[model samples]
Target chain A: MVSKSRSENVQIPIGPQHPALKEPESFLITLQGERITKSGVRLGYNHRGIEKACEQRTYIQAMYLIERVCGICSHSHSTAFVQAVEEVAGLQIPRRASYIRTLIGELERVHSHLLWLGVAGHEIGFDTLLMYTWRDREVVMDLLALLTGNRVNYGINTFGGVRRDVDAAQMEQVLKGVDILEERTKYYITVATDEVTLINRLSNVGKLAHDDAVRLGAVGPTARAAGVARDIRKDDPYAAYADLDFNVVTATQADVYGRTLVRVGELLESCKMIRQIIKNMPDGPVTVKAPRKVQAGEAFSRYEAPRGEDVHYVRGNGSDKPERVKVRAPTMANVQAVAHMLQDGYLADVPIVIAAIDPCFSCTDRLIGVARESGGRGIMTWEQARQAGIEWHRARGIDFTRLNETFRCGEPR
Target chain B: MQETQAVQAELMKTFPGLGEVRVPRARRIFWNVPYAEFARVFEAVTGPMKFTILCTMTGLDLGDNLGVIYHLARTSGVTLSLGTQVPKDAPVLQTISHVFPAADLYERELIDLLGIQVQGLGEGPRYPLPDGWPAGQYPLRKDWKVESLEGCKLGQMGVADGK
Candidate 1:
């Protein structure tokens, strides 16, 4: 057994409320000097008992609840849920609806990838890239609003098919928007490949070997960054992806930089996919009426969300309300891999490493605290940590107290 | 469809006397196994067949018996769902977290919500529940009464805050 008594390691607590994280999550990072020795995560700050609440709601009402699981991937959640319900009821969605579903799914992917790119830039202190990416991302946001009548939660997916229909005028607007995004994506790709500062910060920062990725169940761009080549859209094609042709991007770098490349490359591919879907979309009604009460059966549905594979398992028992509904978001599958990536990394790289997974903590905050047993020799409160920093600087011949007094010029409080 | 059949055939050959192996859809296969052989069969799939990615684990309250489902997938895109049930009186089952580390969270959720005991789950914490939660009060159980929780004592009386 490994020794649990490491007296020199400092356990740094980075928030259930920290500036580094986009949402509430606590990380107890054990640091030896500036290197991370071990890391443990504590979640459940945002758990709303959504799974238990699903059991009480009817099937139709559950879609709205499920859609709220993650705002960025709302369409992906509803699509996965509806697909499982349709399968349990033995209803095949119309071809046109399937095509439109694919359209909206690709649009959502474009938006999500751009949003992630902006966040990744902000994490690395490249706020310029963040600004540029977010500005370009609004193009896709506008297209989503035009096509689905909403920006964040589209609410287009119904039981058997889609609820909204796209007319010719909307198609023209969507195509024009895709053209602009494709151009912007090309520019961003060049920047990602050529920028030396970004490469220095990201390349080999948090290396997740391909084998470790597969063993640890890393999904989405995180897995693709390590060259796993496991895309659910291609592996098990659903929602008109079977008819679509696009490349699954992969990079062998298996670091933060590799993840950046994979996501940006996928953004380009999603743009191409949207163009193809719009050009070849078959003409028909957008929806087929579905029965409220499904027969006694169960089905599992999987969708390739922008982050990774989004899975939903539904069981129906001849009632309007579902017998059971289990949702596994991509963040849940990717969170474990974050612990592995943080090992032996520099303390400064923690934020970028965690953000590389694009962790949606709101969707995965349905878990409790983690228990760890280690020596508390390096544990200190926030005030003590600040004092330690001051003393260290004083020992190095940089007296901050004298400097503060000189700057104050004998002003008394 | 043939891929599903091939997987089913391989499973049957590997572990005989399985309860029922049904192909519910084109690419989906469901195997109903006895509770005793649950761990052994899961080992076979993850070890030999290499379905290392555990999608999720779902626990169901079947009134008299509690059911646990393991949805696993291989890198080559094949998925297999293994299910088993144990009597509610003794809701204990072997854990497969040793084979797939990803099952650690899922197994803990099973234990916390359904009140099932998973053997060999080391250091599994009470997940999706607060530390001060009452013991033996599983919310996902079919017979659990929400009204019974009203006016319940929380935490220790005098250790932190006197009641």
Candidate 2:
């Protein structure tokens, strides 16, 4: 093999194409031998320029663009973005619209978490877990497709409320799917934690301390796994979450396994929440009346995505097009926590550890990118390659000073 | 806890350093605190009211000033949001990552999108924008125009300041 070493420290770009990350997000992992010394993350590869795109779109058109933000968590993004606009317009959605939104949001959570489970399983090389989780996830997506037009970007959200209304038959189908999903998710939760091989590979790996998770500003399952009990749904209580009661799962381990368990636990919680929303649903119009002008104002709206809290800030200028719209997905917050998770982990465990964050490469890509310093024999086993990537970041420089800024929680500035 | 007035008065007493609490339209009560009191105010609310959950954090470029919003909530049905606006020329806020770890991503995102400085955050490169994305080119600014199809390079449109 033609092997040439440029420096003692060499950096290799892991993605925008790595199996470990779902979106086209890249990471420069600097390593020393087989252990990661540091890691640098870069995004903006898939910068659909959704925010800029929102500026050119009409209020109605912005909803569709926001829905496409993440294929998995599209509903949450749409609901949050549309809700912010609705709030600025002072439009009150009908009771039926709110309940339908709650139902669809929970259903989206079911599929999203299941999809994550399947992907997480695949990363750890557990094909059985992948098969079972994805097989069951199809049911939730089918229910979503039945209620809405499309499966991925459900065109249910509008300026005031949902576009579709759920009748008794639709509710029955959703309830049936929820039952099956809950039962299957329970079974997977058992295997996720109890399976010896899975536990051995996941448990205690990518350990992030509670202080570090807080300092790095991890969110969703990443922070929850570190024993930080933060959930936008439970805290902010938008949609049906305000009416329904559910537990916020947390773990003290702050490792790959802890986040895995948190997600696994929430899968069941989402199932239960969906069932409750359907059972106690009210009858009314599915949408509220919205005006042409959004007026000039700025407000921030947040919803609990399957990954974590998804926030959108909308600034309207009394024009059809929004003045400015900014989106912050849960992954944006969780990416900073990756360096803490990878610092002491084995090179072989890098993919699995990164996957534990449930990091959305598409969302991350819209926000940042990692640049690698070239010049090295890029040939090695996956282990050797990752070790070198980690070393490269450490040598180039890795700092977390700005990751610790304080802002008011749950409010708009 | 059942009395909103009592809670408000108690909060005012607890944090005297917080100045001029304003009640905006929609009955939303806001605390206008100095930038340095950001962490203390967060702890006071979440600690006293058990506002243990973070809703969202946002940054705004308000021409003459930069604003950061933090929304917090509790099951007790009390949702309090805190907003601090810093001068645009010298924008800075204390790090609240100590009270709510979830602040980490929001702050990084604020820094990435608005170019607002979140003092004491372990410094890194701007996120969301590519490496070659022009310096000082904030996509969120009201006057930032991306020109046309041919003129735009990557994320830059070169619309020259204001139009």
Instruction: Please name the candidate that would achieve the greatest DockQ relative to the true structure.
Output: 1
For A179-267, candidate 2 gives per-residue lDDT tens digits of: 88878887888887678998888888999888777666667888899998888777557776778889999988788888888888988
* Global Cα lDDT for candidate 2: 0.73
Encode model 1's per-residue lDDT on A1-413: one tens digit a residue: 23355657788989878999999877889988788999988766677667777787899999999999999999999999999999999999999999998899999999999998899899989999999999999999999999888999999999888999999999999999998999999999999999999888899888999999988888999999999999999988888998989999999999999999999999889988988998899988888889988898989888999999999999999989988888889998899899999999999999999999999977775322222256211224335556767788889997767767879752332
**Model 2 lDDT, residue A353, Cα:** 79
Clashing pairs in model 1, backbone N/Cα/C closer than 3 A: A368-B128
Docking class of 2: acceptable
Best by lDDT: 1
Clashes of 2: 40
Worst 10 residues of 1 chain B by lDDT: B154-163
